[model samples]
Target: MKILVTGGAGFIASHIVDAYIQAGHEVTVLDNLVTGKKENINPKAVFYHLDIQDAQVVDIFAKHRFDLVNHHAAQMDVRRSVEDPVYDARNNVLGMLNILQACVKTGVQRFIFASSGGAVYGEQVTFPADERHQTQPYSPYGITKLVGEKYLFFYALTYQLGYTILRYANVYGPRQNPHGEAGVVAIFCRRLLDGQQPIIFGNGEQTRDFVYVKDVVTANVKALDRKDNEILNIGTSTETTINEVYEHLNALIGAGMAQKHGPAKEGEQFRSVIDYGYAKKVLDWQPQYDLQTGLKETVAYFQ
Candidate 1:
């Protein structure tokens, strides 16, 4: 399969690019390098240094004649989205539209979208949200992600374009950027490695479902096998508190740093978890890496 993976130079998509190449798929990567690192790009895949909003994207699509698009690029920072919504919408909404235009114009068959199970659901009323959970996003980042999903629905309905929307939990693992992707595991590991104190915001009781990147890759590979045209939550149906996460990382790093507390960011979700039963049924996807196992690897990477 000839596939175009947007944000293929970023943490998660870069790994996806590697797996796709290893599976012998003709893979092309498109990344602007704003948050994505060039080093993260798979050497075996073709690379393009372009943002998703660029007009030349259509030209690339036309040239590659891609069979599918795995859309992962976005303005993904929640706090930043809160600070500047127009910037967020420009990339997440407008940029997404540009990619969709390219796909529809070139007659690409399937689109595998990377949505947020946590963000889109906002403060989840359900302890562990399922695909059927309500979507009342608390932030601009979440809103834009939801907007993209809605557009995907529209595109699917209007153009008969197939799509798989994978709403991911809080993913953490190797190649994750502490600044942008903002995996708490990565942040803790980096801070500990740098001999700095890792601060836990608020009382540190906030809980999130932390899924591993390798598990996410499996879901993406599975998504390529069919066009189910459904939104599936890719998560563990489990929740871990931020304090617990910090303690685990401290143990993994063997750092004796004291727990540092800070004021919580405004508009932060208190608790978030999502169920993957739907993904299990449709994509046969379930998380394989537990927190401890994933944290060990992440700490090693940072070390």
Candidate 2:
């Protein structure tokens, strides 16, 4: 199968691309290099250094006739979304619309969308949020992701395009940028390795379900062969607090550094954990890495 992965040079998408290539599928990558790094783009993939918002995307789809498209490109920063929502909408919302349009034009069958579990649920009313949980996105980033899901549903219903939207928890591991938002583990590990003080916002009790990149890649691979069009939550279904994550990494790296406390960023969720009952039942996908194991691997990546 020939596949097109938007943002294929990104940390998560790069891993997904490698998985597809390993499965003996022809792969193409379309990335603007905005947040995605050039080195992360697999050399074997047909690489296109262009934005997804461009009309050229449609042309590429027309030419390749991809069997599937894994859309991961987006404005990912929640803070940035709060500051300038239109900018976020342009890239995330409009970019998705462009991809959907291309899918329609090219008669693409499957679209695997990388939706956000961390942001989309906002403040959780239940402990482990599931697919049926109430969605009240607190920021424009989350809103755009939800809107993208809606677009996928529309395309599936009206255009007969099959889609699997995986709502991922806080994804971390090798190739993950320590500089971006949702990069707490990477940032803390980097700082600990460098013997620098790492800052912790809002008492470090803010929690997240930190799933690894490899586990997410596995989910993508399983989704590829799946026959059903569905929404799945990819996560560990366990919440780890910021402080707990810091202490665990510090212990793993043999560091005694104390995290500095600061004000929490606006629109940040206090805690989030996704229930993967549907994913397990439908896709037979389960998270393989716990926080400690994933952290050790991530530390080794930096070393």
Provide the RMSD of all predictions against the true structure, rounded to 1 decimal: 0.9, 0.9
lDDT of 2 by residue, 153-249 (tens): 8888999999899999999999988877658888888889988888999888988999999999999999997546799999999999999999998
Show pairs that collide, candidate 1: none
- Write one digit per residue (lDDT tens) for candidate 1, span 1-303: 999999999989999999999899999999999999999998888999998999999999999999999999998889899989999999999999999999999999999999999899989887788988899999999999999999999999999889999999998889998754357888888998888998888999999999999999999998998886999999899999999999998888889888999999788999999999988987888999998998888888888
Model 1 segments beyond 4 Å from truth?
A: none
Show the colliding residue pairs in model 2.
none
Provide the lowest-lDDT 10-residue window in model 1.
178-187
lDDT of 2 at 299: 96
Give the lDDT of residue 59 in candidate 2: 91
Winning model by lDDT: 1
- Segments in model 2 whose C-alpha atoms lie over 4 Å from true places: none
Query: Model 2's lDDT to the true fold?
Result: 0.91
Clashes of 1: 0
